[model samples]
Target: MTVWDRPEPPARPVPLDRERIVAAAVALADEGGLEAVSLRKVAARLEAGPMRLYGYIAVKEELLDLMVDEVYAEILPEERAGDWRAALGGLAHRTRRAALRHPWLADLLGGRPALGPNGLAVTEATLAALDGLADVDTVMRAVETVSAYFTGAIRREVAELRAERVSGLSKREWQRASGPHVTAMLATGRFPALARAVHDGADGDPEVSFTTGLDWVLDAVATRLTRASP
Candidate 1:
């Protein structure tokens, strides 16, 4: 057959792997949130048939697990913090930063066990940081408490950030924009503490607030450890 007539070599299928699948899933999630992600959608983004992704990820849930683990890879610290307090604090901040970058993550963070290697590493680091600081049950509780705190906090932060984006108002501005309502409420005198807070401008910098609360929680964990010690 003439060169033109010869059947063209089949284009090699774009290499498919778990990493690429997860990356595509993350991109979709970043752009449209977790609910926007699906196996077919991710496959379309990767320019592959949905079936191709099945080889890499068994189901949509597995893809989500991979996406979360990928973020954990970013959250992992390069060097261990000097102490348990520092270690836990560093992880919390890193997690917050990650959630900010991928706000959709708040929906999945701590929603399910990671099971992936990177997720396992993050858990290991957290647990190891508290090793020898307390008994097994106490350490587990401390880890759970810290994780629960940060996950919930990050979700709130992201929600507020999105609200501000939609309303085009910062938190303080939103509160003040309701001045008429607030003023009327204050006149009622029933919400005295809240009225005083509004008048006093009780809201502090969000970052400062977050850090301060985190430190308090860490201190509580320390108290638990101290109580558990010999």
Candidate 2:
């Protein structure tokens, strides 16, 4: 058959790009966690052959990096009219919320340097907040410290949430009555401080705990900035 005479070559599949591919992978991760995301699965979701994905992403790790940067777009914050503390704290809270929405994010947080556009924007905004407050080294150290704090805290919180889903118990419940073994251990008087805190400590809201800890860290940052100031 001639070129125009036979079905017009059946049309091309919908154009595939990195955005669509990353989106499909993110959707799969949202539904079934990170393990569910793979190049083949993403290609399947796009209704394209797996090999077709290579043009956009070279490997699964590259796709994962793109996925992380994509989520960083959600964590990006608007310009706030406040001090550095407000700026940094807002970024931390937004990041925590984003991780909660995309639980798989906890696994990837801090696993690699975020060098993509959105990720760099986040780092830029963070550094910009304290730009004039301290020397370059001090500022770098402050950012690293704050980033470390939130990264670890968010990971732990996500882990606890997963544990709760699996065990059908809240954190407070698990700590206060974590089976007979925990109860027996606590009763042994060798762990007086631990037992007292577990029994008497209130199960404060997680957000509140996160906020409080962030504030403490930010306060420390503020002190360092003050010291570094003229």
Candidate 3:
């Protein structure tokens, strides 16, 4: 066939779907943080128009919900731990891992209800772990309390990690840098506790710090659960 007469091959369909769109959005976020992700950028990455994404995701909020749930899928334990403490601990650690893997998740954690299937399943698994251990209210409180601890902890940890990276110094080193008001403030007798922590307290590894805090929270929850059970 002549060049103009040649049969035009059919146009390839842009395989637009929720999963693909979400994956693109996640990749964008992983590279440049959540604020970097947008329908236009995601669509561009997929070689489709922004409007095409709306069919799968009504708005950016829905996209964020999907992203958070996607991380929840990672947080779910492969097998339920034998006991409630183990189960909650496993879930909390897994969640921390997920947030570390996708720091953007820290921004969304607990910001909204997790109504997606995977997110709901995570809740179900968490509740199941505490089942029969306490009254419904106590069990609910235990879950919320532990969740609140980890979510806030992870956000703080990620913030510190970002700051450390930007400053090119570990947290302890940053605190130890002499002069510039911080040292002067520490020298003031009014802040004895703060000065002691900065000079004498060990700056533990982040993971160790996270696990220690988690264990403390779990211990508190255990007391409540035990009191309420049987």
lDDT of 3 by residue, 1-230 (tens): 21112333333487666777788888899888998999899999999987767656667887787788777899888988899999889988999999899988888887767877788888888899888887888898898899899999999999988888889998768766744687777777889988888679886888999999999999998888777888
Query: How does each model score on TM-score?
Result: 0.90, 0.90, 0.89
Overall lDDT per candidate, in order of appearance: 0.82, 0.85, 0.83
lDDT of 1 by residue, 1-230 (tens): 22112333333468676667788889988988888899999889888888766655666766677788889898888887788888899999999999989998898887767776777888888888888987899989998888888988988889999899899998879978998887997898899888777778656777788898898899898888999975
lDDT of 1: 0.82
Instruction: Name the top lDDT candidate.
Output: 2
Worst 10 residues of 2 by lDDT: 2-11
Backbone atom clashes (below 3 Å) for every candidate? 0, 0, 0
Candidate RMSDs in Å, in order, are 7.8, 6.9, 8.0
Model 2, 90-207: lDDT tens digits are 8899999999999999999877778788998988888887888889999899888898999999999999899999999887788667668877989889999988887798878989
Off by over 4 Å in 1: 1-12
Candidate 1 vs. true structure, TM-score: 0.90
Per-residue error for 227 in candidate 2, Å, reads 0.5
TM-score of model number 3: 0.89
